[model samples]
Target: MNANDNIKIDDLKKPYFVWFEENWVHDDVLHHHQKGQLVYVESGFQYITIDEKIYLLPQNHAVWIPPNAVHKTNSHSEKIKLMIMFADIRTKNSFYHKINVFSVPPVLKEMIKYAEKWSKQMTPDHDENLFLKALFNELPRFVEHSLTLHISLPKDQRLTKVIEHLHHHYRDEIKMDDLSDTALLSFRTLERIFKKETGLTLSKYQQMLRIIKSLELLSAGHLTISETAYEVGYKSVQAYTRSFLSVMQFRPTDFIKTIQ
Candidate 1:
């Protein structure tokens, strides 16, 4: 499939369909569709932006986008694999109505891979539809286990400058007063506006950014654990590991083992 595939997807008559695309490196522009989408990262990671937040979809994980939700996709690597399922809005499953990133359970993961054989529009009352229905039926339960690897960007110019600075200087010793100076606001005002716009305090937002970037570096296998820690701004490996565990609910070593 090419970049125009999305434009053609809505015209297909199926209630749902699956698309298997490998070696994906393109960055999709802002767009939306009438159907909900569940994108599973079959191999490498990808990032998707929606509602002022950027979500990291790592291997063995999936991100769900509700119908007509404006979003875009990006992948830095050319070796990434993606299996996407687009379902009609009429399914009326409330669980399909939100955007979230979650670990794809083994059963559903296999089911999606198995669906690659029918990688095109699927008709209703057909055997494939039954299988597709079963696959989607399993989504809601897994959503409860969604990951917190998304960073909320801010719309306010002051907060945006602060966020951009943090993105570039996250490894440095950052002070709230410095951030306030960057934003041209008082510390209290900066904190208040930052939290109001991004739903996260300044420090928490930077921490989330570090973790998200660390996942990219670690998953690429280009950096050692200690290197990744320091690269993401932790002064020591222990602190980085603790933060990784706190956010990911698993040690960095364990995570490394999985991607290995």
Candidate 2:
């Protein structure tokens, strides 16, 4: 049984709930609940959608979903492992009010792993409840290290066409001319409106996508640094390493080691 089994987490009277599962790729329909959610990516990666934007949850990372936030999730990996927690939203902690993706520090990682033993509804004042409370309280200290790599979906049809093309051909050497042709807009108009819609230049946005896809490739351990770089449109390993470091604050080799 898993979190989506007979038990409805939102209907519980307890202050917290925990669930652990390791399975194949899973997808959830769009939904929302009254309790805040914390999902730790034990293996593989997840794509979480909120407010029409997509956030990538890489291995060794966790994502916080605020209460009442409309969202959906999908995982494309062959193996999927995750630890999920839901908490009462009455703690008055502003930190729980927004979506955040963060690297799980060693301390918190162990804490979350330890929590798997009690995968149940936890009531206030219980020993399990106290531990869960402490874990939740410790999250704020790591907020400063959160990642902001969400891909915002554009409202315009032209921009949407361009973004869809980018998603499919990110491994190619994408040029403004190609994008302008895809969007049916002039290069200058496309650049201006793309930035206005997504808050990122077209090239910057594509770079973010490349880095995000690199995380999955690196996690799967099926390719070398150079091959992964090429798979994501980086012609040189140095350029790929620099882009990865700029976004993830670590080199590809270091990332592989950390997650291992």
Candidate 3:
């Protein structure tokens, strides 16, 4: 079976294969790869809903989706990507068993780019074969980044009321007086309760929520980068880019380029 047709292990000579594409549109269908797949976006916006956790596939960052993990890729009209599929024994590390993100290390990039070049070379030379095998084993150490902001859904009626308000009005420029009146608690009391329960101040939680929601929208490609930024309460594109790049390693436009 062709690796392009579905995840397959049919080719011995081509134990590792890379598929590079631009302007690809994928329907949101749940699927799993038989082999571990490194889904990297060189540029563009895409969302990978992996095992129920929503992850935005930002530019320059790859989601190291493990074998047998059910996931779906969401895109608008365009996506650009490079996928490296590995066989059973070829992977460099046996320790990693879950999805992870690593910095785009130089060695990894050269290996992939070399592989792309090899594909175009179309030779069956022994040296070329050895280079590919060595490249697979040369896969560098992977580092993971924690993107989750701690949040606690409280059982208290007053705090629940405040939480519900923030959820529904993430776009609004919320004010202290408005939050206090809605929660029916003084600002100080609300602040104290939020800190105790969620480990984040009330303002911090709201900002986190807006950024997370904005990320979701940006991933789906439903809104323009600037428009989505504004929808999540950002007053300007620069403010939005700063927040997005702070959490994710790439700018919004770079992200949009990869998903295409």
Candidate 4:
């Protein structure tokens, strides 16, 4: 379901804030809103595609999306709890202009949960205003715990095709010559464009994609460590473990333990 299909941001009042929590999967079409948004994932994962770039937002993380930034999302997992809050342009602060993914501190999480609960109740106007004030104060602190996974997507048509192919065939050992042929670009040209557009070499981009996929698989609790390694194209568990550690800063087992 496309959440933006029915909701019209222009119709809503300015300085608006709406909270939502749900456990469902949605593959939304590319869409944008006039107001900035904050999306918090309590559990599960949300893949947000913006301007050809894809952001993998896992549990206990939040992403701040600037106003009118066209994006789409694909939710993974059974219990994809999320909180979405929107703010008008006039009310947006300096931090709202860029995309930021950060660890959801305990205080901020509690505040959002409280706001959700309070909104459901018929609270007095004064009490609601107090909650809003608190929320505003807490939002600025989010940047302090930011995560550095802001991946960029290629704009070139040929590079875009290469990325798409990699997404589909990440489990296989794809050579640069194959990618060059698929993209219809000379090897050097393809390499230059890939690095310039994404700030990552083709091999590094593929590795990051595999690690992100492995995170989802491990979090789901269905795949063993070795199985995940092979599933994501690694020939051995040790190699996969090393790559995963480099990208995610923790072992797959440690990540699984935290989520469990």
Q: Please give the CA lDDT of all the candidate structures.
A: 0.80, 0.82, 0.62, 0.75
Off by over 4 Å in 1: 1-7, 25-27, 121-125, 257-260
Instruction: Please give the range of 10 consecutive residues that has the lowest summed lDDT in model 4.
Output: 117-126
Candidate 1: which pairs clash?
none
lDDT of 3 by residue, 1-260 (tens): 12234433333355455555555456578877666666656655456677755565555556667767787765432545545445344344653356775445555665666666544232245665677567545543534342342235565677877888887886777885678887888888888887787667777777767776775576556789889988899999998898778755677776555344
lDDT of model 4 at position 209: 85
- Against the true structure, what is each candidate's TM-score? 0.89, 0.90, 0.56, 0.83
- Superposed Cα deviation of residue 174, candidate 1 (Å): 1.8
Instruction: Output the number of the lDDT-best candidate.
Output: 2
lDDT per residue for candidate 4 within 1-260, as digits (tens), equals: 33433545546654556566676445577888887888888777778887667887877778888898888885567778877766665554677778887767777888777767543232235666667666765687756756566468777777778988988988899886788988888988899989999999889988988988887777566889999999999999999999988987777876665454
Give the TM-score comparing model 3 with the true structure, all chains together: 0.56
Candidate 2: minimum summed lDDT over ten consecutive residues — where? 1-10
lDDT of 3: 0.62
Error in Å for residue 240 of model 3: 6.8
Between candidates 3 and 4, the lDDT winner: 4
